[model samples]
Target: MRIERKERADATILHADLDSFYASVEQRDNPALRGLPVIVGGGVVLAASYEAKAFGVRTPMPGREARALCPRAVVVRPRFEAYVEASNAVFDIFRDTSPIVEGISVDEAFLDVGGLARISGSPVEIATRLRARVAAEVGLPITVGIARTKFLAKVASAVGKPDGLLEVVAGTELDFLHPLPVRRLWGVGAITEAKLADAGISTVGDLSRFGEHGLCSLLGGGVGRHLYALSMARDPRRVETGRRRRSIGSQRALGRRPKSDADIEATLVAIVDRLGKRLRTAERVCRTVVLRLRFDDFGRATRSRSFLESTDRTDMIMAVARGLLDDAMPLIRDRGCTLIGLSLTNLDDHDSIQLTLPFEADHGAELDIAMDQLRDRFGRDAVTRAVLVGRHHGDDAPMLPD
Candidate 1:
């Protein structure tokens, strides 16, 4: 008797995620840390091991709290460089498995294994081999989830946490998802969770049972309908590399508090200079500048300006950011700022420069270029702003791109 093979449509996509990435890396590197609770971050928990997570430790929680939860937990500062290296190695393995890889983050990716079933065995077999290779070579544990759609594949991986594998067949997605809580839907946070709870809509089944009109009446049109659609596992999004990030942003903590205007200006200028160089290196230009401010009271505010034309000029970016600062200065003063950040959005990829307005009078792009060249030739510290040096004690030098 001939047995029928599983349909190719049933197993196509795979979501691979490293298990407790940072904490696992620390434990893998040091044998003594194995089987013990591990929390990784400088002053807080960037990642908590499964062992520590049992005690209610979580990422971004204070290190003191994590230690209090699991007194035997080994706390280690984050080794970002090491994590990046391991991520690259794991990605190489992903590329070997399939060409259609979509990276969600450094530690997770969606792989299109649709065409590989002919030569590479079934999706389950491929996932097993991929996980084994990563464990044997990269020395890290990872979980793999296989499903017909990207959304369900990610949910499967989440359900199979900490080095497990789960697969949901195509027609069984609703059966697998409806029993879960509404919080499982993307963009449903604490606020929305409470709102859903108030409406007696707790699970995905409840949301589905509420029907479209009921959802619209309760949560309004857009978000309510969106959740209703997802409750039925109706996502049509694909796993393609076509979706590139439109903008890149970085934020730094001031640690204590900022004092003067000039000091804040210097910090803003440095950040803009760094961000501009990165944009140029990526050959992209941004038409919008955003300034983010976090007050001592933990309130955050953002101000943005859209430019008529896109430019990656360091001085120009800072000038716009400074203009945003002037607009938000009163609020910043009223609520003393604890953190300041800069971001450039509205990006166009590798486009020709569209010069509309005249460049600022006092600014010098040549000086910026010279500094860049010096940093390229000698080192990042070869050039520096005198104001940034020794202005704040224990302040480290700006990081140069590798």
Candidate 2:
């Protein structure tokens, strides 16, 4: 047997971010939208293409407002499925580039390309290849930034936006960081920006000169110390792929169609079944169940419940979910539901969460594993509950990795 050991290298963190994620996908699939300002989502701007952004259009703004900014922009409904597919393909490229990848969202991640000096040329080489692969395979342009730490790498990527690459050489870290705005530092939101600007600290260089005590006095102890360090170009965090999300959720938009209680329950069942499969696949158990609803009037409501014990079992979780649904049945009846979403939170590792009941002794564990295997071998639509027979909830949306 032969064994090979991996080693770390200097300046190996690379931040890869998809440019204009949702809008990019819209343009990529529809050639007519190419080089044209595109906006995804009708009620609110979910994403704006680089072209639309150039017109001062921003995401999460009111759809009417976005259109007002750029009346020429092509508006399209959000296809979560397509976005998920693109996200998964792009993430696959990320994993292929490095074994250590910390996903920030469906669109961006921090990849550690350290210790690939022998197999891969350098951090710059790895990022270049990764970007090329994503463009070729997924048909999306991605920006990459290379630095010694995750923060700088992410900042570099943001600075080099709209399909660009930037490398912050180790020796020139401060020279590069100091010239930027204070808002570029992590945790410096609108309020922080205002505070810093009020203090005459318009740039990172100004904040860097402001001693930690003054910053602490200006921003309070916790946030003050943190920003001071980032201003000084110091970040010790590394790429961590094992840090799973607090919850895994899926939702369906049924538009203004009126659905009966039975129909709603069936839809919820489909979401629960699929999410249950996802929960178990991630080796996680949840203690809380959250139900989110959007009514025909465009109003939203969320209801949640927590259990004494954490569980990964579908039937067990479904019971709790159904209970939540029943509790909100009156609201649904009055409001006329248009969208349904469910999220399982309060997650704990399956290994760390001891079984309160003899689930395996009851033979439920065997059945769950059996169904999972069948689904894996076949498809997600392979195994379903009795209620789902001859019923359609919605198409399966693309998903982020477990």
Candidate 3:
């Protein structure tokens, strides 16, 4: 039986993702790590090289488990500064390739090269040049996948990983996607995958045969309908340019270092200051402050505290974040922490929301606004929190969308 692809198709969406971003950068800079099982982040495994993955090593896995899997692996601490620099260089190339770009994270993005065929050449040609440029300029391996839809493009990129390229031609999407496992679909987590397996639906072809109504009955309406559409490669989303995200966040990998309370607090302050500036610049206010932590044992925890009113002030958000961190101090001390991240969520349009009534004024907001203006006029580093001063690695690393 033949499968039908979506009509009026064009393989224009390009999903470009870095291959083992952190590990690749480490190998690119250090010759000794090349072609070896190099793992970045000794505690939580932020990234594992393709060589390490061959030995059954995966990221976010326990350091002990990774060590056991790849006994000869070269373990190193993550350099957030280097990673951010490389990411900026790579993204410069992305902008050069296409005008419409959506950054998914520090390492991955979706670029729409639908037009510009005359100037940039075919989709494959554009992707080829993009890969070559990133390799030559950033010294990193990037995988590119070109397809008609964003979902298919992303899946194509994943299938062609560790420095490779794949393009799904129009009218041939099902031929490419059907044979892949159902887990390749976005919404299929371990639990859903287990359920699908129990239902004898292992591949996209099997799921398609089971039909949308049947799948809906099995997995509930919303997720089931979504997965059914994806299983058939029918994504209608476009590459969003300059998309304003609801939340802005940043994270740092601390590796196996022993951190004092003061050290952790300093890191938290730096993160809050950076994110607060981003939130304000986006003209958004957040009601929730989320603190994400990963322990030396590779266990992760997320704690969030909501304010009574939305805020864009760094001091106010930082106070709540600090309190959340304080509450998690026992766990951090017990487990030995490895990573820290902060995200501001539950966003509101700052222009629309009247944040301050005369009775509910924030005294610190004036200082916050002044600092933001100074940083905007001069540079992001123009105003720095005093607590982060003189500390090593406290310089603001470029915050990437994630």
Write candidate 2's Cα lDDT for 1-402 as tens digits: 222224343778899999999899999999999999998866557789989999999854666778899999888878777888999899988888888888888999988877788999889988889989998999999999999888999999999998999999987889999999988998998889999899999999999899899999999999999999998888766577767678888776564657899989998999998888889998999999999887767788899999888989888889999999999999999989877788898888899776465555576667889999999999877978888999975543323434
Q: In model 1, what lDDT does residue 378 have?
A: 95
lDDT of 1 by residue, 1-402 (tens): 112224455668899999999888999999999989888753446688999999999865656667888898887766766888999999999999987888888889999887777899888999999999999999999999999877889889999997999998878888999999888888689898899899898999998998988888878899888988888887766677545566666554453345577767777766776788778777888899988876766688999998887877787887899999999889977887656777788778756775457665745656767777887799766777776675532221122111
| Candidate number with the higher lDDT (2 or 3) | 3
Task: Kindly give the stretch of ten consecutive residues in candidate 3 with the minimal lDDT sum.
Answer: 1-10
Highest TM-score against the true fold, candidate? 1
Task: At residue 5, give the lDDT of candidate 3.
Answer: 29
Residue 106 in model 2: lDDT: 94
Using lDDT, rank the candidates from best to worst. 3, 2, 1
Q: In candidate 2, residue 14 scores what lDDT? A: 94
Q: Give Cα-based local distance difference scores for all models.
A: 0.79, 0.85, 0.86
**TM-scores for every candidate against the unseen true structure:** 0.85, 0.76, 0.83
Number of the candidate with higher TM-score, 2 or 3 = 3
Clashes of each: 0, 0, 0
Q: How close is candidate 1 to the true structure, as a TM-score?
A: 0.85
